[model samples]
Target: EVMKQPGTNVIEVADAVLAVLPDLQAQLPPSVHLVIKDDNSVNIRKAFGDIRVTMLVTLVLVVGVIYLFLHNASATLIPALALPFSILGAFTVMRVMHYSLNNLSMMALILSVGFVVDDAIVMLENTVRHMEAGESPLEATLNGSREIAFTIVTMTVSLAAVFIPILFMGGILGRLFREFAVTIVSTVLISGVVSITLTPMLCSRFLRVVHAKKGLAGFMDRSFDRLRSGYGRSLRLVLRHRLAMLAVFVGVLYATVKMFGIVPKGFIPNSDNDSLRVQLRAAQGTSYYEMVGYTQRIADLIKQNPDVDSQMANTGGGSGNQNTGRFAIQLTPRATRALTAQQIAQQLRGPLGRFPGFRAFVNVPAALQIGGFRGNSSFNLTVQSLNYDELYAWAPRLEQAIAELPEVEDVSNDMELKSPRVNLIVDRDGGRTWPPQKCQALEGRALRVA
Candidate 1:
């Protein structure tokens, strides 16, 4: 029976292997070992709960700051309430416009904090001013509303108008900034309405009667007196030699322009953080093990001084990545060391030069704000023309030119071209059957792509 079996296939391999390690063995010594595998999947519900807890804690902390800054709980509550109204309203607009709750949206929200408060601030300050000047709360509220009603309308309209044009912007830039503009415009519009309506109600109901303190008045009066005197002297000097001052100011302005030009015009400025990401890309088809090795080398270089508290690497590829390798590397803070993020990024880039295909991203936050892929630095070069041939020919030359630029990274033709292929020819008259068109079609189809 064993001779009838073909090679190992002819033999009962299961029986042969079982002879080495049998489960019901009366004939073998027991051997034990452990098998290992990786599974990163986890419970999603638990993750959502954790995120909620973190958000609650952060919100509570920020609310505490707001109260402290305003020095009044009611005042803080009134404005803080507006934050949600403004944010929610802004988010609603983004949703309607099919924008995501991404970095740009968050950035616009941060900016709105300062701006949304503007109308509210003016309303509250005006009411307070009227009250301080001896008017009743009712009178102060009505007069304040009347005073800035037109101003608020025009301002809100103007703000909204600014964003309306952005929706018409021609490229990805327009699409990216669209959310920023829309969010700001929407939140500002909502805040403006709240300022005119809700703010007046709160001013009347919540604001405490604050009389000018004698001590505070005396101190402010003295400070202003000195300021007035200084200003009066400066004004007199300028008036006395107006032409000389004008000439001097003009010369200074000219010098300032010259100085501005002297300062080298650089690309994006360094972004701040307690973290820096060093992205590594090796030649196509580099193995994960090789990438891990390179990452370790880069991490070791970073770990040398112990300033980096933590380091991790995640490897992946672009959408159409063939052989090109990619990595998302992170460096974190040390408990003992206090250093600016830009400084740390600079250090990482210095050592990363040893690994040729490495690019360091300092501002992870800013990259997101501009609506680009997270940590993606390379921008597209769009060369539109009536002729496709001219474009195809010029793209490589342009890519070469861009590659020569020290400031640019990942200089590419913005087009994908396949490697050349071999061809076999046959004459149909020599009793050969062939479809050259079909073969050519197959050739195009056979191009191996990622």
Candidate 2:
């Protein structure tokens, strides 16, 4: 059965037992890769099949890169062979320690790619050199590998030691990044093992002396000789003209300092993508209806036609009465969506100029991600002051001062002002417990301000 709906092809799974064949029986169209895996209850095995595909793609890509550079099939195969063992070791350790394969864990594997392959290449190159020389295959493999074993171990331990600080670092961010650190160190150590043992074994079985092109090899040797001679001559010239070189060096250093002084200094560097994060900070006691109206007016332009996939506008003060709300919007997928996420954000920002008594901020993803991170960052300001009134009045002025600068944008003031709210009154004698008195006056400038 087939139904071509551009992004969907209906599969007739009639009378088929999912338990018998847990994977998709029909080939999926490439146009719809992001299949909705909502039926986790029926048979979640389909999810693992997707995971397997992801892992296989990772393996193949790594293998291809190795094969391209090293010019040896065995060099590629060694890591590919050892990766499963490495993953098994990693997974077993994680399982014992109760770690799940999620964003941070998967992030670790991605970060491990460079380090994991480094050790393998080093060991293989060393072993290949021995084979090319007069040494017999087994003798060269053993002795050549032994010479590099200490170096490999030292390098691995050194890399692992650097990661220790990240593990010991305090805070929620540290905890999250710790997973990435663990992944890197684990994969490096595993690669060292594969390098010393499995790499040499593979080299003993498969690596051979390949013929170097005569013109290229000759040019390389001559280039090295020239480079060596050039370095010696340059070093002699520098030593002979030490005083002049020192004067020039000091002048250069001073110029660098001057250049640095002129360079703009700030808390964080600006980013390339122009993602305008238009956040609304309304006055106190603002109704949920008011909030929803503002959000809907803003989101109305977003949700029309075809660009938006889904948007979640939190339409009330959270249960905490924080009087704040947020939205997480996902644009339509890459293949169809014409506008970049930033472009959509800019579209929202442009309409905001038409509104009054509201503040909107244009920000980059870097600014949003790092600023929104669970830390005491983003809106950091320092002011030398004595009085609370001074703080309230001067803060907005300071914000204005900063906002007026070409570099600064979307400045805001905190809770110095508020919206008027309904106040319940009760007087038991007149069917209420209280009355407006001079001590607690409920009229005019004072009550309205409060």
Winner by lDDT: 2
Backbone clash count, each prediction separately: 5, 7
Q: Kindly report which residue stretches of model 1 are placed more than 4 angstroms away from their true locations once superposed.
A: 1-81, 92-100, 214-423, 430-450
> How high is each candidate's TM-score?
0.52, 0.59
Residues 1-450, candidate 1, lDDT per residue (tens digit)? 123243343124534643554443544445744211111112122334545565466556656765554455666676666667777888788888877554566666666666676677677767777888888888988998799878877877787787788867867678668778888788889988887888889888887654543564456657768999999999999999999999999999999999999998744554443455555655655566776676677667766745555555555544424323333333343334676665665565555665665443332333223443433343555687888689778888987987899976544442544444456564658633556776676564654433
Angstrom error at residue 213, model 2: 9.7
Every candidate's lDDT: 0.62, 0.63
Winner by TM-score: 2
- In the range 154-233, model 2's lDDT, one tens digit per residue, is 98899888887898777766867787677767777887788788878877877666546355445665776899999999
Range of the 10 consecutive residues with the lowest summed lDDT in candidate 1: 34-43
